[model samples]
Target: MGVLGQPINFGVSMLDDKRQEEERLQVLKGYEILDTPPDGAFDRITALAARFFQVPIATVSLVDEDRIWFKSRFGLSATEVERAPGLCASAIFSDKAYVVKNAIDDPRSLANPLVVGALGLRFYAAVPLVTHDGHRLGTMNVIDFEPRDFNAENEAALVEFAGLVIDQMEVRLAAHKAIGSLTTLIKTVPELGIDEVATVCAWTKKILIDGVWYSFDEFLSQKLGLTITHSIHPDAAKGF
Candidate 1:
């Protein structure tokens, strides 16, 4: 997580490993996220931050192991960047806000391509998006072409906006997870409905048993005791 160790001109996986690609994909999937379209809430936050700080570009970035991907970007639609030594990378490593008043004067960021390259970014400030579970997700930040100080007011506003961005991410993931669970159940039994209490009970028991098992679905289909036709009521069979 330290910025010093990360690469300078990265293409993809910084660490070379035979299994790292699979591991990387797993890491991306663990969040149950990847290749998703941009969300309005995230984009709005970036755009508003750009206007508020008067920066030409603003972004909500997620730092993967080797690259930086933009969840939402303003004044730009870049997909990824090398996880090179940059102000944002340093901020993520330190788990604190990075404020580079003047990129040319700041030795730490002076050599960063974003500052020296065609983008010509000068003033940079970013607040780290540390998750509630303590994961260093990435940063919410804005960049401007001018060298200027962000007063206390501006800095505080940036941090507050960063928090909102994080909140939106958390909410989005929660909703996605809820929808996935519901979908799984519906696939298991197509007639799933609130009034169908008996089916719900059966599904619940089967899912519970599946949790302790490696091949839960196969076991459930064989032993869940769900009949294709419910003509013989469970209660009637037991004389309950």
Candidate 2:
């Protein structure tokens, strides 16, 4: 039996870890948030987490291949660190919040460089940023220099904050899609003649092409042989 009184199942744990990592990477890529510029929305959440938990460090961390990058960080200088020997990497493996009261005392974390090295992180608590389809993208975590107990209440608050982060991600994705749709509409405007106007419904925003009325996107695809794609404008967010 392990410290938690459950049998330590190494084989099952390794298999599940592999499967979860594969699915997680796919879902993480879909968000299109990796290496993106910092946003106020994510920054506010991390700042609030640090204040609420009274911790010196907090972060909105996204676990990418080989390294975990901070989308937003409070009380930390380095933006990223290697996946191994990192608490946040372990946090992403579970659906619920993961907490370690003291890294120096925990067998799993005692050897971690962050625990014994310069950073000397002693306390850690994180809630996995899970998607609707049940993939853990990353974590929202708080760290402390001294060990501290993380109760159920603390976990709940962190989970709620993680939800807010996901909400912002979803909104940004929707906005990007809308911008792409609008750009495609403008691009397919079939070079109107001096006095010619394409038949379009003001209410529905559908266009009449040939003898049938079709949705703007569908009309463009069918009439102009163009595919609707999301493209970021140069003046907008630097790169999509």
Candidate 3:
């Protein structure tokens, strides 16, 4: 018996965590950002973070299932690293900032390779890149060769940088979706002939999808990542 007179099912807890991770990966894939070329916009963010924190390394890290991919990096040559028990992997578990002022002395980070190995990382700080719908994608990271104290103000600034990163990601995702919709619209118009200028029904609000009619609500939710609801406006109701 446990807290609520039920057995503590550790396996069920693990399964829940696994399911959540699967959903988070699905959200990450929709961004279409993995393995893509670097954007100057993301690069600028990393550069600014390094300068702002006076750290030797700063990166926008995306945590894939087995690896950490650097979308943008400053003062670091490698673009990725294995997903281990330290750094971004550990940071993504929480929404708050993760800081290790002195990895050499902190029991939590003492055994991490980045500290014990040749790179000799002494300091680390990061804020998780969380989506608007509450999925943690990765982290905005700052690293240093020498340990230093990071106060509350510094954490707040890092959090703001994370917000900027997520903002840019959302903008990019919207553009990607818009481009896809435009492409579909163009392909459908030619096949439908000059008589039909659009693939959507004006009255029913149904869209032509692969020669089949699908509700506009379905199209928006499936293709554009939008949530749909039904309602009748007073002005529109008068028409009936």
Candidate 4:
């Protein structure tokens, strides 16, 4: 079935809806994850996905304007591939999982270079990585050189794994925002002539001020002479 620009084939739908595409791209960019270095958190999940599905390749892919970049991968050396003819491109159109039992037999993928060219991809299954607000960023996918079928159980597992991937993305985004806020706090606040800046742990959210270890709030209160209060909601706390 064709939606607006092209026919949907190979269990893949074209992500060509102009307005929606723009919105999706905006949300994807908000994560600030594109073109980032691999992390053990994401890499371990991809590796486990490959092992769980018994597939040779698995990846956490982020769909960009012109390419599908692998945030994490197993058994794949390349970091990214062109968007056209890419299975993950189609996977991003919806929040549901997309599966191709045999790429060679699927009209949408028969001509795909990844299927017939050097990589020789065959079986494929991808669960969309959807944000909490319902934007689909990309996919958590498994691949094999030989054609194979994926049962409903397998699809469910893939979806769960995809959720884990999304969770990681959320954590990374949160950490980034926190750092940005910290930077702003440092710059905007008046200089207290505290000549030496203390060491801070980004991951642990611990700060060292005046040669003493303190929680983020303690550090802020001690250094900036500011009062810190937290809201029950995490997002609400962003204001402080």
Every model's TM-score: 0.67, 0.70, 0.73, 0.80
Poorly placed runs, candidate 4 (over 4 Å):
1-14, 191-202, 208-215, 221-240
Per-residue alpha-carbon lDDT of candidate 3 for residues 32-86, written as tens digits (9 for 90 to 100): 9999898888999999999999997898988777767889989877777666566
**Per-model CA lDDT versus the true structure:** 0.64, 0.72, 0.74, 0.76
Task: Give the Cα error of residue 95 in candidate 2, in Å.
Answer: 2.5
The predicted structure with the larger TM-score, 1 or 3, is: 3
Residue 62: error of model 3 in Å? 0.6
Model 2 per-residue lDDT tens digits across residues 1-240 = 322232211111222567667877877887889898878889999999999999988888887766677899898776665555456656777677889999899987887666776667789888888765566677888988899999989999999999888878776765556545745655556562212445555436566656677775675577657888876444234312
For this target, which candidate reaches the highest TM-score against the unseen true structure?
4
Measured with C-alpha atoms, the lDDT of residue 124 in candidate 3 is: 89
Q: CA lDDT of 47 in candidate 1?
A: 88
Candidate ranking (lDDT, best to worst): 4, 3, 2, 1
Please write out the lDDT profile of model 1 over residues 72-108, one tens digit for every residue.
8897646667666667656765545679999888898
| Poorest stretch of ten by lDDT in candidate 1 | 196-205
State candidate 3's TM-score: 0.73
Candidate 4's residue-wise lDDT over 1-240, tens digit each? 111223312222446688888898898999998988878899999999999999998988887877777899898776776566567657776467789999999986888766767667789899888887777788888989899989989999999999899888888887677766776676565574333354667557576655676676776787767899865445423423
lDDT measured at residue 20 in model 2 versus the true structure, 0 to 100:
65
**Model 1 regions more than 4 Å off:** 1-28, 193-240
